[model samples]
Target: MEYRKIFYNVSEKDMSFEDVIDRLKTFITADPRSEYVLSVGTDSHVHAKDTKFITAIHLHRKGKGAWGCLQNTFINRQINSIHEKISIETSLSQEVAYHFTSDYLVELSELLIPFSDEGADLTFEIHLDIGRKGVTKDLIQEMTGRVLAMGVEAKIKPDSYTAFGYANRYTR
Candidate 1:
């Protein structure tokens, strides 16, 4: 079970779910004055027989530097439908986002409230690959709606770097 949840961090060794949360806590505490955004997104690449999906969880400290990790999932067969791909991507992101439940987010936010004077803040988001452009335009409503129902902020297209950039990088 632990093996399945291991997330690969480029700047450091691989980490478990617990390790990632602990690291984020340390990062936020080290400088409570910085703004933080914890975002999750997923992107995929299709192969001849299968597709490789990469979901990234990014902890960004506003103008400052940040930390992140990736989890990869592979489907046994190619997914030709745009809807299918988008749905799967959102599902993967949901899996990661759900880990940060309401209670967990409150705990994390409590850490920053004390340093609010130093501009300390946090935003949680789920970035979707589908946008209002190209072939994905039709999916904008459904996909974003799915994320919104989770009670976390939802971002798309130009604003969704976690899926468009971070996870996309490794999917290829």
Candidate 2:
């Protein structure tokens, strides 16, 4: 059931969307001078009976440190189509990014305004599971287009650690 969504990370677990926003705000203020990247991504693994999808929302304070949270979705059936699987993954990432509305961005940006001259900034990204290499190549435009259409940046492959790295780690 997608009714009550919750996100969990190492420092905290079972958090709501508002809670994630609050924690992220705290993380930013904790080191206001650092550049930040807020990313959303999803990855999936198919098992004998089901396909498990893990969506991750990550906040990075440059090279110093980072915090992330993830939520899982399951389909009680194998996802044989690469298109379908990757499509769902992209959708999940979009769902998370959609929560960070223009108002939220303004608030987040205001937090970094003071340190902007020092290179402190905020970037919002939607990480797609599709890439420029391998079978995912064909779907790059379509998937990335979906994300870009939402007025957010999209990253894939070697650059998209959120989907291919963070979320992938938990899909297992």
Candidate 3:
């Protein structure tokens, strides 16, 4: 439950789910006019006997910059298959996105109503680490489809900064 602020300045420390949700709410409530794009992504690093998974949530405020937080977990198992690794990463990201959608997003939506007429559209994106240029290329479709089935948009590879940038940075 560690919190790593990637785009904005904030003290990094372990945070509870409630703390994370409150931080996210603060970002939205502070700027009602800004359109928000929320995204989740995960990256993993496998060691000798364990795998470290880092997941991130990016709250992008349209043209204005964005702020994000990350959490990591360590699994005491060797992940040797690329497909399994990518699937796990996508799963982790999806789970976090689901939490935001099911819980925090509802609260944010109420705040967004007054701004609806002003053209504020919320976009929740699931960023995947797979792309068409690497070995993960073969997995792009399946992973993207999984996200789509969840009724959310998906971004892969070159477009998935949350996974490759923030999450990857802390996956040690």
Q: In TM-score terms, which candidate is top?
A: 2
lDDT digits (tens) for residues 1-172 of candidate 1: 2324778877766688878888888888887777889999999999998999999999999888988999989999999899999999999999889888643677777778554465778899999997888999999989889999988889998999999999999997
lDDT of 3 by residue, 25-46 (tens): 7877777678888889999999
Off by over 4 Å in 1: 1-4, 113-118
Clash pairs for candidate 3: none
Ranking by lDDT: 2, 1, 3
Better candidate by lDDT, 1 or 3? 1
Q: How many backbone clashes does candidate 3 have?
A: 0
102-167 in candidate 2: lDDT tens per residue?
447778878874544666889999998877779999999899999999999999988899999999
Error of 1 at 85 (Å): 0.3
Model 2: residues with Cα > 4 Å off, grouped in runs: 1-3, 116-118
- Model 1: lowest-lDDT 10 consecutive positions: 1-10
- For residue 140, give model 3's deviation from the true position in Å: 1.1
- The TM-score of predicted model 3 comes to 0.86
The CA-based lDDT of model 2 is what?
0.88
Clash list (residue pairs), candidate 2: none
**Which pairs in model 1 have colliding backbones?**
none
